[model samples]
Target chain A: MYGDQGFTIFDLQLWAEGLGITFGVFLSSSILGLIFGSIIGLIRYYNIIGIGRVLMLGSEFLKNSPVLVQLFLVYFGIPALFTIDLSPVEAAIITLSGNTAAFIAVIVISSIDAIDKKQLEAARSFALSEWQILRLIIYPQSLAFAMPMFVSLAINQLQVTSLVSVIGVVDLTRVGDIINQRTFEPFIVWPIIGVTYFVLAKLVERIGARLEQRFSVHQASSEI
Target chain B: MLDPAVMMEYMPAFWDGFIVTAEVSILSIIGSFIIGLLIALLRISENKVCRFAALFYVDIFRNIPFLVLIFFAYYGLPEVGIYIDAFWTGCFTLSIAVAAYVAETIRAGIQNIDKGIIEAAKSFGFKRVQIYTKIILPIAITSSIRPLGSVFINLILTTSILSAITLGELTSASKIIASTTFRPFEVYMFLVIFYGVLTFALSAVIAGWHKYLNRYNEA
Candidate 1:
């Protein structure tokens, strides 16, 4: 059993599949989180009645709690209580995306606040409507300010995706666990898994830096 | 639909787990604070090698997930003939992993120090050590109290990961209660709120402390 299991090409296929799942969950959840979180942030910015404060309270707990516990709640707790079928992958996506939204919401609010109010007033004086002012004046500057935080958040969330494995999502970490169990070589298996994540993080950082530079350029050119 | 009565029965076991979590958290906070402070200092040191080493330490730990690092320590240590229980391994891992965060915050704090103040201390005939102990570190550390508080709050939350190694921390203990009581939803939901409230209360206090420390400043 062990001889056939030792470093097979099939194992490499498994690793690739697991890495794909990890990246897939990460990218889709991040996109969803950004859209939902921005809406929440916009609600808060506009001071939407009752809804804003309730959303804020919910996100506060979401942000403060451990992601592992949150995963268990979504994966195990939700199905049992709600009597709904939630596969591991679905649960991972739901939980990670919601978690990401909570964080991105905070970043959105703060970055919007970081925009100078006089800029908003100046746009208003130029007879711009509220929606036009948001699109033309507010969006670009706040996005530039939020880029660095967004980058860090992306890197952190990528690592947080590892927890999905505990819920049985067969991510890279779970694949490592499977191979380690079969071969009983923790020393080799774990380092390989660790380096894979490290490289992914570095890649995210490089991409983020490029995005930041581009946004800053946009801000600079607009100011001129 | 959570029965508070059912949850209450597990309080004794949960309390024991809370004690373990508290011990690991306190030890790690102390450990990370010292290690982070040294690295923060090293990052600002004159020698290029020291600076590079510090940067390497922060980069590796900060990017790698704590779960991975913990798995590495928990599984890899005994393979090399270094046997230790999950408790110590957890404490050690948390300290090293969290120190990266603490060091970054402290580094930012140290860099924020006014150059004129350091120059003023030097001109006042204070030795280099005195300048650091008296003028530099105090201002840097004080200014960074809020950020460090958040870091420590995060460290407390990270303690939950120790459960994966079967260390019987809060998460592990609750896992038992959940299974035995057949109430995974209720048990974990309660645990989530427990941690959320704990961190929320902590950050509030840290904010007040930060404000108090900066009260004398005109800035």
Candidate 2:
């Protein structure tokens, strides 16, 4: 039922480019989120004077609110308020990273708490510095505990990358929008886009499962 | 640069948007719960077809983004001769999408039930339906109140996405206010805090109710 403006070979290129953008944005934001989120987690773990509480409160607001509103605040609000030019991609990265970081902080804290208090006491008796204790006794165990959560979060964050299309990011979803608009073929266009996302999510799930398995082994071996 | 004065003038608009959001959330919460319960039952049913069908539904809906699902429903529905407004479409799509999460939560609760209780019900000659309705559902639901609350809270947040189809819910309302006042930062910041507080308050209430309901177990 589509006319000459129907699907074209060029559409393949557009789809590929959209896929690249989606993956690129997802990777960068997830990495940034992990770093920042770990920092927040560490701060809370150490109980830094005043900064940890403030950061945790900020992260709570980030966690509780919708990412779309945060996107608008960073994309439209920040530029207007700060008089700085902000691109859609930049705003998306900032918002998604902050959001991911908020969740990550909680995961980190809980995983560390999962470690035994006795381990900490033993390390103290050995005259291990706080840094040494964290490095030796806490890091490996908490990481193994946190692996499954991180994997699920990674899968979640991948799906979240789709939201960038709303802000004119020309991501996969945006490409589908463009193609669907031109072709007036919602069924054909959306299913393709949806399948692409489905495959990606499944891929993440598979990879995450493998990593989870590896971490579980590491955790088991470390106990011995 | 931060202007409370502008926001105060726009409180009515925000309130109107909040009402729409509340309507969508409340309706979807009920819609999703019923649908989710059915799917949860289907997932654990003895029939292979029912089990696979329910699993497929959960997998597809959970794996895909809600935005994409809503877009499909919004645009694709009319082509097949189903005409609905943005509000109903939003509620319908949100119900189906969020129901996947709800089903999983409920299923976990169902599976976690003590096997001995089911055995006892069977020994008492309870019909399958009776066991499900009189025993299984009540226990599963009560135990899962907290997870379901988070799921519903997430449903409330997902309503903002309906704006893409022009539903004019809270997020959409704030979008309009931001453009009109030319103060997106303040508008969105207020919206963020507004949603944050709403969710926090709701979660706190859910926790209390959960504790109250499970007081017997605690004792």
Candidate 3:
């Protein structure tokens, strides 16, 4: 029972565009999160003045709360309070990046803790500088330890990207919502959207596994 | 500017919303725990098909976003003549969705049981069901309180997503007050702190419970 305004080639174009936006938002937020999360982790690691405690407290709030509320706070709340312009896409990126950074900061600290304390002591006795110890002793091992957690986090965050649609970003979920409203085909439309996300998550898992293996190999060879 | 007076005026509505959130979270916690326990059993069963089916359920639910799953339940169910309302829809989807996570946690707990204990139970003439209920599940469940607590805390946060379906939960209520008060900043900022404190207090209680349950192991 194909209606006159049923699925068309242009829907395909819209689908592709939605996929691109989803990937764009996910990738940009993830990279920014990783960078900022690392900085937060390092500050805590160094116990740099009062800033570390304040940053950690902020991160705890970020980690504990729902990302949806965070998105609304940034999108609707901040702009209204400041009387400034902030688009939905910008708000989505800002909120997701902060949320991702909260989780990543925890992962970084835990992974670094996973490394043996004696390794740091050995490096210190060998007259290694702080930078040298971090570079040569701590970094690689922690990366290996953190890889699995990172992969799982990536998968979780990819699924989280779906929430951006609530704030009016035309991501994959929003595309499904639009088509479903028009076609009245929830069964057909939502499944396609769900499968797209499923496939994307699987891809992330596959690449993460590969990266995990590579890091483990590097750790082993470098150990010798 | 933050306005305490504006927030005070909306306290009644926010309190009502918080009650709904608490109700849904409690119901879903019980629901997911039961479903997850069953799945964990099926996952570790001797039957190959049971294990495979359990694995498939976990994979599908875990990979798909909760919002997609909620939309499917909300919209698709009505079309199929199921006719469940939004509250039940949120609870149903959440129970099943969070069960995937609960199942994984319980399964991990189950697998870590010592093989000798199972054999000991068997040698003492315990039935398979008896062995599972009395020996395996007790140990696994007691040891997993901490992890299961985190899962439940996460489930509480996820109830906010139910707002999208017009369920009038805490976030939804906050949205209404924000628009009415024209103080989105103060409203959402308070909401954030509210949720953060809620989770922090929960995890603290859970940590105490976990420690109490596993106190024997510490010695």
Candidate 4:
């Protein structure tokens, strides 16, 4: 085996590119998951036809299984089963989004439940439509209640994004592995990589705190 | 193109892998629990240094991903002249990594104790040790059992990453089976379901235990 290759400026470029991919995948998957999960949560809340139970069961499996296993299933297993060409990034996004959605569903259901039934009943007395009640009452309160949890979950999901590297996605963790293999400097390489993630998470936490403060204003109900 | 019958031949091998996973999980659960308790105690200590150190430990561990930590322990330790095998490395890393979460959960439990209860304990002339051991800890831990159980369940899931370090755990064994059988899809899918069912059962038991312990506090 060749001794560890010395570090180069090119390696820094690779690191930046890898960071981009990691954040790109994390952002897209999170937004998509939130959309799908809110829909699932709303369906459950409204008790839609025959499918809510099935959806919940699906989310449970998604929630409970290890992300690495889910990644493998999507990247390797699905291609072998269906004879379809799948890029590592595509598989990573699909799997991570599904996983994120599962958690979002749980949060959505609980946050909605946190709102008062009396609020809905009161809205009904005012000749308000269901949609109007949802938009005017349930949305603001549930979002306020859900803010802290959403922030924590976002931070956790950023860490979870590292697992995508296992499926051959050239994310930050994979970049670290490549550099560590070449440089033979585990101590230097990994701490840098880990610190990158930590800082990103801290950034998310700060923004979330700001959002939480803004939402806390809505937490106080009007006397009208 | 799915065939379930192929798995029948690999059942014994899978069983062996399951045993390893179970062994490692049990050991780490115990290891982390002890560490978690100490750290949680440190977090609430009267001494400022102890509290700061404990918080720093928890912060670093919680922020970094488990895979990164596993790689660090598995590879970085060798450089520092500690030559443990993959199995021990996996166990040690999992314990230390998970202890962050366990400490936080336990700290929350401890903090959730009603200030009034501790004041009453002080009025009873129970000293600090008695207040902690006899009065506060039991109520805190029992009340927080459900959250603590989730931490354990997460610890079990984290064990699957040990396979990445080539520790012949359930995932690694299944990897071999999948390659040999030419059915990667079925093998991994089965593994997903198996882990899902395992965690679901563990959570159910934890819920039951929480209910039983909190029977007196139920509204």
DockQ for all models, in order? Answer: 0.76, 0.86, 0.86, 0.81
Q: With candidate 4 superimposed using the best TM-score fit, by how many Å does residue B16's alpha carbon deviate from the native?
A: 1.4
Expressed as tens digits, the lDDT of each residue in B1-219 for candidate 1 is: 666566788899999999999999999999999999999999999999999999999999988888889988987899899999999999999999899999999999989888999998888899999998988889999999999999999999989888888999999999899889878898998999999999999999999999999999776
TM-score (chain A only) for the predictions, listed in order:
0.95, 0.95, 0.95, 0.96
Put down candidate 3 lDDT per residue, A1-224, tens digits, no spaces. Answer: 43335787888888899999999999999999999999999898898886988888999999999999999999999998899999999999999999999889989999888887887888899999999988977888899889999999999999999999999999999998888877778899999999999999999999999999998864774456
Off by over 4 Å in 4: A222-224
Question: In terms of docking quality, how is candidate 3 classified?
Answer: high
Each model's C-alpha lDDT?
0.91, 0.92, 0.93, 0.90
**TM-score, one value per model:** 0.96, 0.98, 0.97, 0.96
True contacts kept of each: 0.73, 0.82, 0.85, 0.73
Prediction 1 global C-alpha lDDT: 0.91
Off by over 4 Å in 3: A1-4, A218-224
lDDT of 4 at A10: 91
Clashing pairs in 3: none
The DockQ score of candidate 1 comes to 0.76
Model 2 ranges off by over 4 Å: A1-4, A221-224
Instruction: Estimate, for each residue in A1-224, the C-alpha lDDT of model 1 and write its tens digit.
Output: 65226677888899999899989999999999999999999998898885988898889999999999999889988887778999999999999999999999999999888887888888889999999988977888889989999999999999999999888999998998888878778888888988999999999999999999988864773466
How do the residues B1-219 of candidate 3 rate in per-residue lDDT, one tens digit apiece?
667567898899999999999999999999999999999999999999999999999999999999999998898998899998889999999999999999999999999988999999999999988998999999999999999999999999999999999999999999999999899988999999999999999999999999999999853
lDDT per residue, candidate 2, A1-102, as tens digits? Answer: 554487889999999999999999999999999999999999998988869888999999998888778888899999999899989999999999999999
